[model samples]
Target: MELKPIKTRKIYEEIVEQIRELVVRGELKPGDKLPSERDLVERLKVSRASIREALSALEMMGLLEVRSGEGTFMRRLKPESVIAPLAWMLSIEKGTVQELLEVRKILEVQAAKLAAQRAQADDLRELEDALENMRQEIVNPELGGEKADLQFHYAITRATDNKILILIMDAISDMMQQMLKTSREKLYQGKYTPNILYSEHAQIYEAIKRKDPKQASEYILEHLSGVEEELNSHIE
Candidate 1:
């Protein structure tokens, strides 16, 4: 039989996805033991290196655990458990903050457009509540926007009824907070007023409520653009 060529980069991912599918399909439940490395090496029709690399990644993702004295075992999927370390590692990494923000702006603007199409009464109320929090926090003793800013965006993400948007937002919350801190420090105290930001948010919220994607996007873009220009002017 002719050997099928397996590319190294994709082989690892192919092996990883195969194992994940097994668990997802309930062929390997949590706590079920995976076959030995030798067994996998034979069954997978791939190299030992590919097997090892795949297993190592799975272990890092908390999808599997390897015991030296024993063997590898399937693990439960838990988003709650993964978030803390993910947040911490992401928070300290350079370049991720702005990159993450740019990603969020794209999603959120589109999400706002979608929300305008789908928003219900309760969703409108939720956005209103978030806006209220921003109002209350304007005189907040805290120097930077914290819970108020997150609550506002989170409400919009929820209104979109999109799991992907919500998950991405949650994963990057830590970095967003840090970026908020940096941006706030530079521009929070001067050249702009809290009332100005509050008004911008109100405009976005209203546009979403009315199912106007264009205006919703415009409001967020205007708001973000101001901050972006300011950040650019001061970039070191």
Candidate 2:
């Protein structure tokens, strides 16, 4: 109920905070439609632009879903959604890209190790499907291939069966997607051929399929390091 008239210069941010607070406090439960934009502007005494901006921000955070011809509704937000504010900050901060990649390497290395030991038939099928998607998309632009690459990594993480690790991965999924896209584009533009990329992923898949945790971890690390080198080469 701290939803008062806006007094701050960052009116949109204040509005976002108040609405988010209400949702967090259970004042706005899941599937509860919010007031119209005009009504919200009138109630908060803020400009229409500010209200729109606030709602858009909340939508990006997965807190609100805006339906066409219908009002916005509160969503049952995930832990990843709650971490979005931090994720945004990390995305733009200096030197954060390297830090993010390093963290990804650490988490994914462990994930790969665990996947090697615990991956069931379903998990193996998922990984194979993802890899096949990547292979099929190699002749096309990197967009579809990049998406499949992400799916492959996510499958490995799911194979780990660690909820906390999965949540952490979800929290940084956006940034990770961007990084993969950039690295892949750079690799394609440079020395890497489509076949080379396919080979790298296939090697990793083979290691995991063999249930060799050590080999899986090593292959994934090497693949990531190669990607890091490609990115660094562009910077230099």
Number of the top lDDT candidate: 2
Tens-digit lDDT string for candidate 2 (54-74):
888878878789888988998
Per-model CA lDDT versus the true structure: 0.74, 0.82
Error of 2 at 229 (Å): 1.3
Candidate 1's C-alpha runs over 4 A off are 1-61, 65-70, 76-96, 141-144
Q: The CA-based lDDT of model 2 is what?
A: 0.82
> What is candidate 1's local distance difference test score?
0.74
Model 1 root mean square deviation, Cα atoms: 5.5
Q: Would you list the clashing residue pairs of candidate 1?
A: 116-211
Residue pairs with backbone atoms closer than 3 Å in model 2 (clashes): none
Which candidate number would show the highest TM-score if scored against the true structure?
Answer: 1
